[model samples]
Target: MDMRTPLGRVRGLGSTNDGVKHWWMQRLTGMALIPLTLWFVYSAVQMSEASHAEFTVWVGTQGNPVLLILLIICMFHHGQLGLQVVVEDYIPSESTKMTLLIAIKFAAIVFGTSAVFAVLRLTVGSS
Candidate 1:
């Protein structure tokens, strides 16, 4: 039973387009997160008893900043993708959905940028 209207057919939404791209991205981020998260957990455990200065020095080490930045980006982006899916599935009102989605994206961008900036500052500032 086709539930779409003539306009929907013209619109070419749902799985007809865009969905595959979103699905791919979501999966890719998830996969990326696996190793990144494991690395983070291992690093944290390795640094469990370290002092703040030691942690700061560790963050400033070569490659650590880049890895931390990548972690921040992937984590935030993956979270935003999941939130978007939930909003799309649960939210019924179009206007409300769009607003929430926009807000979520904006928040993610803001927080991601802030985190990256903090990492860069800490890693570079003390150098």
Candidate 2:
């Protein structure tokens, strides 16, 4: 069967939707994290002399909430992306690849949600 037509090899059947938005979002989030991560590291270093109670108080403070939330979101987003890449690279069979992808996504969602809930509980309960 001839795969090419006068239009030249399915050239007219381009993607019905674009994925540039998703690519842009991933890059934007990554860019946002650079400064956020540096701020977090600096904040942590500044708190090195703090006692355990003081450290807890610092984490529960209003100033830290935005950073903490960003950290949580970025950590999970990066994790999910990494796992997906791994699955795509290593898994040979299509069925197994899909199963692993779903599993990874489920685990990421569960872990991220639990972590955020725990942070919220600590911060809110302490206040």
Candidate 3:
């Protein structure tokens, strides 16, 4: 007696092409973040002992705008990827996983936008 159904035997078995995209995106974002995060941390540490006026002046520089934007982008992208992996690994129900993923994406968008806006307001308003 054959153990497999005719349909199962004939159907091609493999991924639907999602795995490679997800992996590549994760690694790409991670690589982009390394330099951005290092610069952020270094700037933060440099500002650790700065007075208010000094700190504001430092951030008012042109380089700071690009750094701040990079930080915001990297932060949200990393957050989204991390949350996705968590949801995929732990959430068993399809409905729940989908809901959580959507929620995470929106939350990341809202928070990231707000953060960038706040940074811009501070930097632009100061000068």
The candidate maximizing lDDT is 1
Candidate 1, residue 24: how far the Cα is off, in Å: 1.0
lDDT of 1 by residue, 1-127 (tens): 8997889777646721467777888899899999999989989997999998999888888888998999999999999989998998899898998999999999999999999999988977565
lDDT for predicted candidate 3 compared with the true structure: 0.82
In angstroms, give how far residue 19 of model 1 lies from its true place.
1.0
TM-score of 3: 0.75
Ranking by TM-score: 1, 3, 2
lDDT of each: 0.88, 0.76, 0.82
Error of 2 at 25 (Å): 2.8
- What does the lDDT read for residue 52 in candidate 3? 83
- Top candidate (TM-score): 1
| Model 3 Cα lDDT, one tens digit per residue, 1-127 | 8899988886654322256677787788799889999988989999999998887777777799778887898889888988888888899897998899999999999999998887787787555
Error of 1 at 75 (Å): 1.1
Error of 1 at 71 (Å): 0.8
79: Cα error in model 1, Å: 1.0
Separately for all candidates shown, the number of backbone clashes (residues 3 or more apart, or on different chains) is 0, 0, 0
TM-scores, one per candidate: 0.82, 0.71, 0.75
